[model samples]
Target: MCQTRTVGEFAVSAGDYSAVVVSQGAGLREVRHAGRLLTESPPVRPDEKPPLSAGLVLAPWPNRTADGRFVFDGVEHHLDITEKDRNNANHGFVRTVEWSLYDATERSVTLGVPIGRHPGWPFDLTLVVDYTVDAATGLTVTSTVTNSGDVRAPFALGFHTFVRAGDAPVDDCTLTLSAAKTLPLDPERQLPQGDPVPVDDTDGDFRSGRALAGVWLDTPFTDFADTDGRHVTTLTDPDGRATELWTDTGFRWAQVFTADPDHDQGFPGRGRAVAVEPMTAPPNALASGDDLIVLEPGQTWSGEWGLRHRDSAA
Candidate 1:
C-alpha cells in the first residue's frame, strides 16, 4: 500500500517520491518526469532511510578527505568515519534526521534542521532547505545556513541529485557539462591528492557529449563559467528528451558519479543513474581551506539550484 501526506497545497508521495511543492511559492517537490524518477525520496520501509537520489543538500562540508581528520583554527578536528573505505566523513548532517515542514502551501514547503556543535564539527549553525515547484517550470531548491556560533565558521554546500533519462539505459544517454578543469583523485580511496587538471582527453571531460553506460566516475570538476554565473549540465537520451541542471556562482564544483551494481539499485540494463552534483567547495576543503566560504558571527549564506526539462525540439 502507498502512503500519502498532504500539507496545504503540497502533496508528499511517500515511499515513491517525498516531493513537496508550494503552489504559491516558486518551488516543486517529489517531481517525476517521463516515466523515470527525478529526485531522491525517503524510503517507505520502516528500517530504510531515503535513497541518495532526487535532491539532497550537503552542507558545512561536502565530499571526502584522505583521513577522517581536518585542522581548523589550529585545532585538529576528527569526524566520524562515514565512509570507511576513504576513512572520511562524506556530506554533512541531516542525511538521516527527518526535516521539519515549517511552511507549506499549494506550491512549496520549507524543511529545516539545526547542527549543534559536536566532536567532529564544533560549530553552531542553523540550516534550512526549501524545495519548491513551479507549474510552468520544474523543481527548484534553495539552501540557507547561518552561523549561530560565537566564532566565525568555515563551510560549503552541495546538492546530490541522481538523474536518469526516463526509461533509457545510462549507456545510451549522453552527458554535456561546461567545465574546463577537474580534480584528480587517489584511486584506492578516491580522495583528492594533487592540483586540478584540464578535462581534455580524459574521462572527466564532458564538454562534448559522452556516453555514460559503462563509465565509473567519482570525480569533481571546476572552471564552469557563464555570463550570469548560471551554467548548465545536461543529460539526453538517444531520442533527444533531456534534463538540464542549472546552478549559480556559489556552485563552483560539480561532481559526477556513475554507480556500479555492487552499490546501486542494479537496474537491469542501467547499473546506476548519473549524478549532477553542484558543490560550493571542492573535496576536503576543511583541511585545505581552498575555496571554503567562511561566515562571520551572525552571518548568513543562501543559494539556489534547479532542474528544467528540455524537449528535443528546443
Candidate 2:
C-alpha cells in the first residue's frame, strides 16, 4: 500500500514556548512550554495519518454522521463514508486534504483551503486556520469558515488535541470540565443514544474534577459553566501543574475521552490518555439539526480555542 506524504511543516515560538504545525490538514503536531510537553506527541509517521486524530483540526462537521446521511433545505445529501466499520462519515474530508500555507511568521502561521461541491458535500466553502503563540498565554488557534455557495450551507467544527500536565501519566492526573449534561453514546457505534442526561452522578461527570484512573469516556458534554463566557477544560498532574484547553462562546459543546486501552484505538503514550475535544455542535448534528451552524452566501463563521500551561508557583 502507498503511504501518505505530509508536507509544509512549520514551527513557531515565543518566550520559552513553541509548537510544530503541518500543512496537511493544518494539524498541530506538538506543543511545549519551557521545553516540556503540554500536549501529546502523537506518533505520526513521515507519510501516515495522525492516529486517534491527535492534534488535528476537525471541521465542516466533526465526529460521526451516522450512516453518512443528512438532509438540508429539504434536499437529501449523503457523505462519503470514511469510518467504514461504523458506516459513518468521519471528521469531514478536510483532515487529510492539503491546505495552502498562505502566511507565516516567527510566532504564528496561517493556512487555508477551498472546498468545492462534492458527492456528499454540496456547498462551496473556505476554511482558514491561524496558529499563534503568545509569550504569556501559550498557543491560540482561530478558525474562520465561510460559505461560498449560492445556497445556505450547514456545518460544525471540532478540534482533536490531547493534553498533558508536565510529564505525568494521565492516570496520575485529573481531568476537569464545567459541563452540566452528557450526551449518552452507544457502546457500539459511539453515537448518541438519547437526549443528554445530567452528569451529577454519572460516569461522565467531571465538574469538580475527578481522577482519570480507570475512567472511560467517549462522550460529548454541553450546557457549560464558563468563566466570563469562556469555557475551559483542564488536565492537572498531581503536583498542581496544569495544561488547559479553553474555547470562546462559539464552541458550546465539547467531547471528552479517556483512552482506555481497549478503546484507545491508537492514542499515543502509556497509562491513561485523554482527549478534550471542543466542538461547535454535538455529534450527528447534521442528522438531528442539533446546534448546527448554517451560513448564507458570503457569510463567515469564526471561533477561537487554545492550549496553555501553568506551572505550580509553590
Candidate 3:
C-alpha cells in the first residue's frame, strides 16, 4: 500500500475573519467572517484531494483547451487530454501540484509555484497567489503570473470558489450578474461555438436580478458592465443575506454553476451552493485566440478578486 503525505496548510486570521489555504494547488480550504461560514469547506483526508474544484486557483489556462492542443507562433502544441471523456485538457497544470509558501502574515499568506517547461505546456512561468483577509473587507485573492521563458506564453486565469450564504439553499437565492451577453455552449462538448448572444429577452437575463429557483446554470457570461473598473456578481438569500464576488477589469468573464444534486457528479453539498468562477477568458480560448493573455518574456500580469458577506439577515 502507498500513502500520500499532507503537503502544507496555513490559516490566516484578523479580528473575527479567517481563511484556510492549502498547498495543494494553493486552494482556499475555508473562509469565514465573524465566526460564520461563508463557503463550503469539505473535510479532506490527508491523502485525499479536494473534490469539485472547491476553491481552486486556476492558472495558465482557466477552462478547457479543446483536445489539449493549441498553436502558437506557427507551431502546434498538444497538451495531455486530462478530460478523457471530453477529449480536452481541463483547467491548468498547477491545481494538482503543490506550491511553496512564499510569504505569510497573521492575516495573509502567499504561495508560489514555478511551472517549468513541461509536456503540453512548454512555457516557463511563475505563478503566485496571495490570500488576505481584513476585519472589515473579508477575503481578497490575487493571482499573478510572470513569464520566465524566452518566448511569450499563451495564458489565461480564473478562480473557482463555491460560495454560500449562511444555510440557504442555492435554488432559493437570487443572482445578479453585470453581464450584457453570454455564450451559448455546445451541448456535447460544453464549449462556446458561436458569437455571444445578448442576454436580453432570455432566461439568461440576470441584469434585473432574478431568483435562481429552478434555473439551471453552468454558463459563462461576459460583456461585463462594470462601474469604476470593478465587476460584481452577487447571490442573496430570501432573508437578504448576500455574498458578493467582485473582480478587477482583467477578469472579464464569469462562469456560474448551480451545483445540481441530481446530476451524475454532484458537489458535496449539492443544491445548496453556487460556484461563481471569475475567469479571464471563455472556454477554449487557446484555440480561438480570444482574450487569451499573452505574457512576453520578463513580463508579469496580475488580477484581484474576493468574497464579501452582507449580513442583511441579521
Q: Return the top candidate by lDDT.
A: 2
Worst 10 residues of 1 by lDDT: 21-30
Runs in model 1 deviating more than 4 A are 1-29, 34-36, 40-47, 52-54, 262-270
Whole-model Cα lDDT of every candidate shown, in order: 0.71, 0.85, 0.83
Superpose all Cα atoms of candidate 1 onto the true structure and report the RMSD in Å to 1 decimal: 4.8
Summarize candidate 3's per-residue lDDT along 128-149 as a digit string, tens digits: 9999988888888988899999
How close to the true structure is residue 40 of candidate 1, measured as C-alpha lDDT? Answer: 34
Q: How close is every model to the real structure, measured as TM-score?
A: 0.86, 0.95, 0.94
- Runs in model 3 deviating more than 4 A are 1-7
- For residues 110-202, write the lDDT of model 1, one tens digit per residue: 767777776778899888877666655666778888999898888888877776666677779899888899998888777787999998887
Task: Give the per-residue lDDT of model 2 (tens digit) for 1-314.
Answer: 11123457788899988988888778888899998898887776523567677788787899999999999999999998888998888888788877897788888989898877777888999999999999999999999999988989998999888887878888889888999999988878889999988988777778998998877778899988879879988898999888988999889899887666675364555546788899999989999999999999999999999999876672
Compared with the true structure, model 1 gives a TM-score of: 0.86
Report clash pairs, candidate 2: 4-47
Candidate 3, residue 38: CA error in Å? 2.0
